[model samples]
Target: MRADARKNYEHLLTVARKVFTEQGNDASLRDIARRAEVGLGTLYRHFPTREALLEALLRTSFGALAKRADELQASSDSADALITWLQEIIAFTHEHRGVIAPMVSAIEDHESALHASCVTLRSAGAALLARAQADGKARADLDGSELFDLIAALAWLREQPSHASRADRIFGVISGAILARRP
Candidate 1:
């Protein structure tokens, strides 16, 4: 990819992310190209297909999230760090829910890159959870896989316009549960 083409591709990702958030998974690729000041050919050249675009968007977001979990682990109090990371993950899910839905559907049918990314995510989250538990700040019995499932459920709730507040409340409950003192 040449410098200008790379720039155009990055611009398209940014524009597509915003459009997907506002207009959802059904948002038009043509509109995305128009907003990015590119042609349909350029969009297809970069993304190839709508599913490809969605997967790339998901990978970008999930990569940032996994990175953030590492950063939080280094600086914050262990329990606070875990809770904060969970909150950020939930927010990412809400923002990318449109793209995530299809990726999730694909995973349900068979193994794919989406499944690989999910495995990576769970591994990262598990490491953080282990650190927190070892520090005696989080519930010792909490399983990372279970926590991840809860996060996914919460994220799904956040995708709905009417359930945003409900998602927040549920997050609070989960945070409280995980942070409760051990007997």
Candidate 2:
């Protein structure tokens, strides 16, 4: 990319992050272009779709979450690692707002722009869950897909204003159900 084009791309990403943080992932692309002082056509040239823009914005976050999972998996107790990663991922999705839906949708849609990142995030959490289950700290009946679904469900709950206050308590209940009792 040319220097000016790269600058515009980075500036758009920065402005988009602020807009998304304030208005959520569903914030208007036109508004982002306006905020970034770029033409709508320029924005489209850089990110052809809303999901493409989101994919660019969240790529680093997705990788960080995956890396955090690896760090937690190696450094923490099995059950603790799974729960911690769950809490972190829920926080991540909640922080972005409105992203959970697309993420959930992307998990099953191979053609989605967000599919690869969502899959990587899910696989990271799944690995932690697997470690917990292998250590006999988690329920044997659960699988990676179910765990991913649970994360999506929990993250979605956090998005609801009515349920936001109860999210932590609800998370505790769900996590408790996923774990085995100590002897």
Candidate 3:
């Protein structure tokens, strides 16, 4: 790309991320173009659709999350790795409010551009979950998909950071139910 075009592309992406985070998926494309000081055509030239923009904005974070899960799984205990990964997912969602709903839907829609990223995010902690279950540390019945929804639930409650205590209590209950009971 040419220098000016590259500059415009980068600026639009930065502005779009801010606008989308502040106003959500329904954030106006024209508003994004105005904020980026670019034409709507330019924005469209770079991102053909709103979902495309959303996918672009989320890709790096999801990639980082997958990498983090790998690193944690390699270095941490089975159950500990899964817990740490879940917390990181909650943190990621907090950074990008209103994104979870789209992600949840896209993950189930194989045709969505964001679907693969969601799958990567889901699979990240899944290995740890499997490892824990196999090691007799976690419940065999629950899988990573359940943990995925649980993390999303925690992210949805992020407005009340003070709810950490309540979250911890709930998580404790879940852990007790999911952890293997020794004789």
The candidate that wins on lDDT is: 2
Candidate 1, 18-77: lDDT as tens digits: 998889887999999999999999999998878777767788677878888888879668
lDDT digits (tens) for residues 1-183 of candidate 2: 999999999999999999999999889999999999999999999999898999999999999999999999896599999999899999999899899988988899998899999999989988888899999999989988899999989999999999999999999999999998889
Model 2 lowest lDDT segment of ten: 69-78
Error of 2 at 121 (Å): 0.7
All candidates: CA RMSD (Å)? 3.1, 0.9, 2.4
Sort order, lDDT high to low = 2, 3, 1
Q: What is the TM-score of each candidate against the true structure?
A: 0.76, 0.97, 0.87
Candidate 3, residues 2-38: lDDT per residue as tens digits?
9998898889889988897888777999999999988
| Full candidate order by TM-score, most accurate first | 2, 3, 1
Task: State candidate 1's TM-score.
Answer: 0.76
Off by over 4 Å in 3: 159-165
Clashes of each: 0, 0, 0
